[model samples]
Target chain A: DTAVSQTPKYLVTQMGNDKSIKCEQNLGHDTMYWYKQDSKKFLKIMFSYNNKELIINETVPNRFSPKSPDKAHLNLHINSLELGDSAVYFCASSPVTGGANTEAFFGQGTRLTVV
Target chain B: LAKTTQPISMDSYEGQEVNITCSHNNIATNDYITWYQQFPSQGPRFIIQGYKTKVTNEVASLFIPADRKSSTLSLPRVSLSDTAVYYCLVARSNDYKLSFGAGTTVTVRA
Candidate 1:
């Protein structure tokens, strides 16, 4: 079984169209995150949810929103897609403790292309 | 939050050792250094984590100086399959956002 999985591994749409990417993890992690990797292979944090609560929100535009129904799933929705939105979006999860360190596991990215 | 800096790419050969260094000048006291590996068309995988000195595991080893300003990931006898992008990150226990920089892309050749 895939520890972390994302649906529609690839998405290609036109400009101004809205789209969504779904992510789920079976790792029993309390914190889930969404990261974007641009063409230069730079990974940037977009948002994070700890037990379904929004914990980290980067300086991303309002068009990108992350919704976590539960601790295991975090979905990202993008509105009014632009050419600049073309990149690979990845979902990740990590077990958090009150004062301990842990690592995050990422899912196969969803490559979104806006033309 | 500690911002990290690392090389964009590196080259290595089979059966050779590879070391990638990451710098975080403003690391916090409770921050831990972590490294992740990513292959083409796939997400990143956790390789190792360390706080200071040295920490070795089955796949790799992490070496950190006393200052904790930088860390190095050492791979022994790397193979062609070891060619991947390696990301260095520094985060505290309470931090939620993991700022992944343009990781060092290790290319292991024959």
Candidate 2:
């Protein structure tokens, strides 16, 4: 079974269009995250939710919003997307232990193209 | 979050062992070093993690010195299929905010 999965493996939309990507994890982890990978292949964390509570919010534009209905799911919605929004989005989850940092499991990722 | 520095790219041959080093001079006592591998068009996958000394897993091994300023990820007998970008990260134990720098791109040639 796939531990982490994201829907709409590919998305192509015009400028100013809005889109949403859905993510789900079956690992029963308490923390979920959304990361954006640009064409340069630099991965940057955009948002993080711990047990449905917002914990980390980067300097991402307000057009992007993350909603977690529960600890198992975190969805990202982008409003009025622009040309610069074209990139790959990844969903990841990890179990939070009080000790050393834990390993994270990432989904296959969704490639979004804004024309 | 501690900043990590790694090689921009490296080339290797099949049947050779490849080792990529990452430097995190400002790492704190509560931070841990982790390595991740990412193939083209796919998300990054966790390979190994360690607090100090050495950690060996099925796919790779991680070595950290006593000062915790640097870590090295070693891949044994790499194949062409092993070509991927390797990332080194340092974060606190309970911190879910992971900062990933430009990873070292390993291109294994046959």
TM-score of chain B of each: 0.98, 0.98
The candidates' DockQ values read 0.62, 0.66
Clashes of each: 0, 0
Q: Residue A73 in model 2: shift from native, Å?
A: 0.7
Q: What DockQ does candidate 2 score?
A: 0.66
Q: Which stretches of candidate 2 lie over 4 Å from their true place?
A: A97-101
lDDT string, candidate 2, A12-73, tens digits: 99999999999999999999999999999999999989999988899999999999998999
| Residue B81 in candidate 1, Cα distance off native in Å | 0.6
Docking class of 2: medium
lDDT tens digits, residue span B1-110, model 1? 78899999999999999999999999988888888999999999989998889999999999999999999999999999999999998877867877788899999999
